[model samples]
Target: DAARQARYSFLWESAERMSCNRLATGHHRDDQAETVLMRLLCGSTLLGLGGIRPVDDSGRLIRPLLELSRKELEAFARCNHIPYAEDSSNLSEKYLRNRLRHKLIPEIERKYDPAFTRNLILLGEEAAFFRQCLEDRFRQLRDSLVEWAEGDSPRINCPAAAELPLVLRRYLLRRIVFDYTAGGVILSGRVLDAVDRLLVRGTSGRRLDLPGGLVACREFDFLSIGEKKSAPTGAQPEQIEIKGPGKTTIILGGLRWELSFEVRPYEAGTNNVFFQKEGAEGVWEERFDRDKLKFPLYAGAWRAGERIQPFGLEGTKKLKKLFLEKRIPCSMRMRIPVLRDSRGEVLWVCGVARSALGALSPESTSVLLVRALCLPVRGFTGVTIIDT
Candidate 1:
């Protein structure tokens, strides 16, 4: 499975890289017949039995030889004196397909019927026809039921999906998975069944991790399928010195941090010292007690075995433990910005926690405002603050 997936991935990557729209594969009728038999023996669905599609739904992958038998192709190649090499692995019994092609299929053809290959091809054609019909119906139902939200990730209304028939529901979920991953990964039958069960009976906040760093989250009434949160790479420690009321900018973890220092009167409105506003959606800004914090603040990525005295907490807690309680992905923990004092004590973890030392009080007179914005990644539009 892994090897096949890698080969297809390479094919797609090469196509995109070379700006080629069409990818052609030499999958012949014999291969199609074998695939149908193999899938049938594996108890595959009707769509699976459809075997090798001449053209993928995306209409980019084409199988020009799908209707031609392997024998016919070989005969033509010999007549033209075309050079070719035989793959030894095709004769190995270790692989199920090889066993079927060499042993089981030949046995069935000899003992039961000589026309077994032709029958399998016919079955594939019939299955393809039925699958196309089912897909049309599924598309209609999806149009009426699935509600897409505006964001990088795609979300669907689980409540509406639950109203669909079990088979349709599974199909819709699988389609969403495929679309979200850009065909990079496919959900297996077991995974699809698990997701279907979750859609029908699972409660909100439940989540399932799919392949290719994607996740399916069950919200109150919808399901969100998107890329998993990953931390920034190549982050290094930085220091920002606040001499007085001034502004400075520092870059870390592919993000820009604009620090504006000011001495403002302490407000009595909220106990929370950190006042934040979205300059624009996903752009973060926050205020802290500048006077209370120690000077020569260190800014850097999170480090292993670090501990922080979180506000309202009795004592310092392990950063890893805190991240777990916050449900932060492991890959993102180090990517998060960490603010520490000259004494090496953590003052804040960006979008997550504020140290007790940085908390505002009635006696606090000066405030330090920090604004952060991340440079857009390849697929994402903006940075989302992972609030705890």
Candidate 2:
């Protein structure tokens, strides 16, 4: 198994380095029969029982001779004067495949059906067809079921997902994990069972540690799934300074945000700032009373206990409270930029809330139009604003 893994890794790496589009292997019908038998003996789903795919899920790896028998290949080689060397390890019973090929398979073939291996191959083909049908169905339902955020982290609407039949729920969850891990962990039943419990009866704030460092946390309305993230020791969160009447671009947590600062006459009923939508997205573009703000603002991660007197609100509100009210999952709150003025007062909490400090007024002229475009990163459509 280790050797097979290493060989496959090398092949993938080599193909990428060489800029090759497709990778082909020498796996044959006998290998498929052996794999099916092994999977059945060890317990596997119909997808696993499909054995070696002629074309991998990515459609890059191909087994051209997957349906050809070993005997047929050898006969063709002999007749055409084509020489091929066999692996010496195949004769060793130390390996399970070798044991199956030499002892178990021969015994079964001699004592029972003469076409036992062929029957297994046939079973694998049928299973492969079944697996393809499942994949097609999954593709159709994946988007509405799974919401991918933070570039790769996948979450779901718990109540909506829970309403699905158990089989579909399992399939959806399995595909999500498979895509995130890039098929690293295989044939894992552990995550399926644990997450099912989480969805069915687990209360909000409850969670299960899934395989591959993946975590599933049940929120009030969302089942957030993401890998464990360890903060670096002795590393401080970098605070980027935004000093400009021009555009400044920044990358944070695998996302790109463009912040623009322009001092222009505030035109009534016309806000040039755009973030792909209205309502909450308007927060990304705020026309602040420029005369009120101190220059050279700093943008950083949200600090604990930070409060802001949000525009149109009477008093101050905690950043945490605002986030909860906005229904922004806790996992994303920290990554959201918290913009502050030079005096260290909160000016805007990025896409969440804006301070009433520099809010535009009817009498205010030459407004500071702060526009932010979130760039539709990783399927996350956050506010790209014109105001603050």
lDDT of 1 by residue, 233-253 (tens): 645444665555566666554
Would you list the C-alpha lDDT of every candidate in the order shown?
0.74, 0.77
The stretch of ten residues in a row with the least summed lDDT in candidate 2 is 273-282
Model 2, 1-388: lDDT tens per residue? Answer: 6998998899989999999999999899999999999999887877779888888768888899987889999999999999899889898989888888888998999999899999999999999888778778889887887777665677787888888777677777888777888886442776687888787778777878877787789876778778877765655567778776888876666556778899998767654233345542323666687888878887777777889988777989998888767776666666677778888788887766788888776777778887766655666666322232
TM-score of each: 0.54, 0.66
Q: Number of clashing residue pairs in every model?
A: 0, 9
Question: What stretches of model 1 exceed 4 Å from their correct place?
Answer: 1-35, 38-48, 54-119, 126-245, 248-255, 267-271, 274-280, 283-286, 383-388
Model 1, residue 40: distance off in Å is 5.3
lDDT measured at residue 150 in model 2 versus the true structure, 0 to 100: 68
